[model samples]
Target: MSNRIVKSSNLLNSFRYQIENSQKGVLIERKALLSSKNIELHFYETITRAKDVLMQFNLPVIAVMLQGEKTVEMDGLGKFEYAPGESLIIPAERKLKIDFPSASIENPTQCLAFIPDASLVEEAVYDYYKKTDTWDTKSDDGKIDFSADLLLRDEAILQTVNYLLYLFQEKNEHRDFFINMTTKELIIRILQSKARKAFLNNFQKNENRMTHIANYIKRNIGNPISVQDLSKEANMSKSNFFTLFKNSFGISPNEYIINEKMQKAKIIIQASSDRSIGQIARDLGYSDSSYFCKQFKNHTGYTPRQYERKHN
Candidate 1:
């Protein structure tokens, strides 16, 4: 909807100190020497007002802003402001023109970039597909199609990164083991973040159309939706949309819509205990509380009142 900057909980303050005190003449430090088998971590500090510096990576990279802000220009995604505590996912071999608009000698722009092997990302996606049992794994190209640019400042991922950075310093026996495992977990988390849900629903080739419709229904559960309107949105005739929707999601469109409504209803009921069941039903587009209660029971084996009672 609108641009929102996410702040990280686990920030690298010590690393910033290291950069500020490090020897001059080096704008950025390529810490390839400190890299592991699948992941490389690099730190960058701009000393001057650098603009339009071209950069491209052979593998997929996740860059986190540690200090100050940057005006970044990239192919396909265009230009945007990168700030401290924000993490950006850059695709393989994509050209980027970065500007250190706020960089200076006293307060330089510092950033950390984590470059992970493409194969690691593919492995994580394959494992997710296998777990879901939703797609034919044999047909998967083993390439990540991150159609949209992702900027994550998620608490969980920040915590994981903090742990990995600490593990990089510790000389323990299972340090690499933990680092690799956490890196894979980070990949999965990025793919499944709510920010990327809409893109994945509409653009991901395997679960494409119906997933889009599913997310659309979920996003607009409070509003009225008609089969005709949904068919139009899917760019298909009513009959064809219904058939394809059923084939993709294994449930009729109406059923899926109602299920989404009830799911939201449950959340609202649990979250706002002061609100009445009738109000929850009406808010979810159910005109009749009796009908809503019946449907809720049929779907979840719990009436609205009972569900509320148990949760409360």
Candidate 2:
């Protein structure tokens, strides 16, 4: 997957905003960049280091980190570091306490805040279900509800966000139409990403057929597993299994298997120093070390050795 971290040069060239002198009590400065019937985009920059900064939003907001970092805390979600390339989904009417650990005039904290209209979100959800052919199903309502703040590092979401930022700054007659379309795409991506996360987090405890398949895969991840095996495990034909799995999780069975394997590979590489790349590949059921390295790069944008060096 391509890295979602926006390049500093892109932001500096596209978003040209002059920061005003900080008021007596304000910790973060905000500038309204774009406003429309469906959405609003704001540019925020904090120049001074600060802690326990309170922020409240009446509408559900998506904030993308452009530069610098923060430690964010919400009511139910414990505090965590928010860094560049990450996006946070804050629920409507939620209170957030943020700490800017590194902000200065030379390297101020920068982020983009998006307030999507309720109607816009509804339209996106409708389109998501319609395209997925799940609109008429009673089980899947395609609702966007965040139990806690979601931190997203998906490549698709970040690409859409970068496009939206570019569109917001362009001077064109059809800009609004393009922006609306892109915003809907962003919302759909968020929905799919969030659903996949929820399924992964609860699959161990859930008794659903998909969860059962997931459990089986994890239990035997280091073995040679095939789509036919998964279909048999679910007591369904291969074609039906493929359709149902893709519809439920937005990924093919093979893709999910590879994803899980790559995740396991990352843990193994980072947790121990004794294992070589070839040894790790064999442990993950990959007979060829070259193929494993290629798969790892495709999944994580880093080679095994590179990832180990960077993280460990």
Candidate 3:
């Protein structure tokens, strides 16, 4: 029971850290773009760029054109022309270049750029290359339209965006936490408001035993889980449970748990450098120090001590 509690605590903290640290920019230098503190929500007053404003991105980002005529050419994501009120989901695997040829310097354009926690996209949604069976962006461009409601002048959203903007203007340690936390919460709002309906609908339509177990495992990753327990939970025999769970998640439950543990451990190591590796192993509920170190080495190619030394 105590081991379960310790695992639960470690899992909770590490999961949150992974979600928060999911994005790291290779070329980000400013306090604004460099930090993954909060899902970045900023309303740009607009700047007059050369006829073709080209911005290179190492990661995919989203842009919502609130007010202004603009064109976004996504390298692999696709191209979009934004009118006064519309939104676009910028794919991360491509370089995005936008142009505002007709914008007058006298009246700079007003648009909102929503920098979501890149990690959310990294996990929840698959990449364009692998989405042939899912929502194919090029095959069905009309099916991928973004929501314009989020851009409206609502007081709560406006205030939140404004507060984040001011916070990013500073170069301080607090900005890191502020940026990560804010971005995560904002994306959760987006998921709840827009994406939740479609996902819930899909889940309901396919409420089979396998899907149920898969979904439950995601929510209860830190628990002391077993194939027998999960099989019983789904009212299936052990053999049937193994077949279905593997079929759905592409991996068995035990493999999934180990992967989740290593992922959580990586986040904890990245965030808190002062914690001893033995402490991390114990916190993650590894009873044997040597065993945990071996597992960590197998998964990451770096032992726990090496990971701490390099990451810190």
Candidate 4:
């Protein structure tokens, strides 16, 4: 759930030039890398440590950290460390007070601020609601809430942002067209990731039927739970339940069950050093050790034993 910075010779060359010619008086040196009707990408470099530097944008901006670290403070969201392999989504017109604690002439802090057109975001939201028939009820207007900032570690978003950077840095006649297409994908990924976060954060306390089902699954995660059982709990047909659950959380009931079990298995493995893989599988209601191992590897990219070795 982390992003890796994409470094290139072109980027390094540009960064070197900027570092050498950095302004002495300003804390942050801003360079507009690419600008189009639908999107704008700007590069920022800070050559010295500073505190409480204010920044605001007219349009929603996604800030990607490439080098060094920053302590960012927003109105509602307090201070948090913004470092490499992470991103922050700032709503339009929200002011940010940022501190560059590690910036220096030798190692300047670098970041990219991507601003997609407001109309583009609205279009994406409209398309999402139309396709999924799902809305965020937590929002008073039944829309995705962007008033608060969002921190993201979604790799898909990171990759898309990197591609957009590549497009911005390169000299291509079709750059705007490609940027428009790629920005649309990035917007959808952000929306879906935000929706998933909202659902996970509120599912425990929210008294909706979906939250009730989520609670039941969490409580009985070590038991055999099927969509049929969940449908019975929801008092709906199997197909209807499946659609409703997926639409609500962007994940199927069975997939959610597997994810919950995998998360629990990770905890059990990390909490104890003496537990055997077969026993752990059984504890998670997996009668077949081989199947459990397969699922664990598929979900975590590590086998149960490997995960234990790596973590413990």
Clashes of each: 0, 0, 8, 0
List ranges where model 2 is wrong by over 4 Å: 1-4, 7-30, 135-149, 195-312
Ranking by TM-score: 2, 4, 1, 3
The model with the greater lDDT, 2 or 3, is: 2
Query: Candidate 4's residue-wise lDDT over 1-312, tens digit each?
Result: 225677432464543234333445554544445576788777776768887888888765778888888898877756788878677777567778989887876777888888777666556555655687664434444334433426877788888888887776667898788888888787778767754433323221213567668878998888889999888766567998899899988989989999999999999999998988888888888889999999999999998889989998
Global lDDT scores for all candidate models: 0.67, 0.74, 0.51, 0.73
Residue-wise C-alpha lDDT for candidate 2, range 127-171, written one tens digit per residue = 775578532211133333343326777778888988888788788
lDDT minimum window of 10 residues, candidate 1? 1-10
Q: lDDT per residue, candidate 3, 230-289, as tens digits?
A: 776665578977887787778887887778778878988999988887777777767677
Please identify which of the two predictions, 1 or 4, would achieve the higher lDDT against the true structure. 4
Best by lDDT: 2
Error of 1 at 38 (Å): 2.1
- Greater lDDT among 1 and 2 belongs to 2
Candidate 3: the clashing residue pairs are 37-179, 37-180, 37-181, 38-179, 38-180, 38-183, 39-183, 60-92
lDDT string for model 1 (1-312, tens) is: 112222332334323233332235545422222466777776666656766777887765677777777888768767888767677777567789988776676776767778766556556656665576543221133223333336666767677666767766667888777778888887677666743432233223424555556767876788778888787666567999888888887888888888888888888888888888888888988888899899999988998879989998
The TM-scores, one per candidate, come to: 0.50, 0.54, 0.39, 0.54
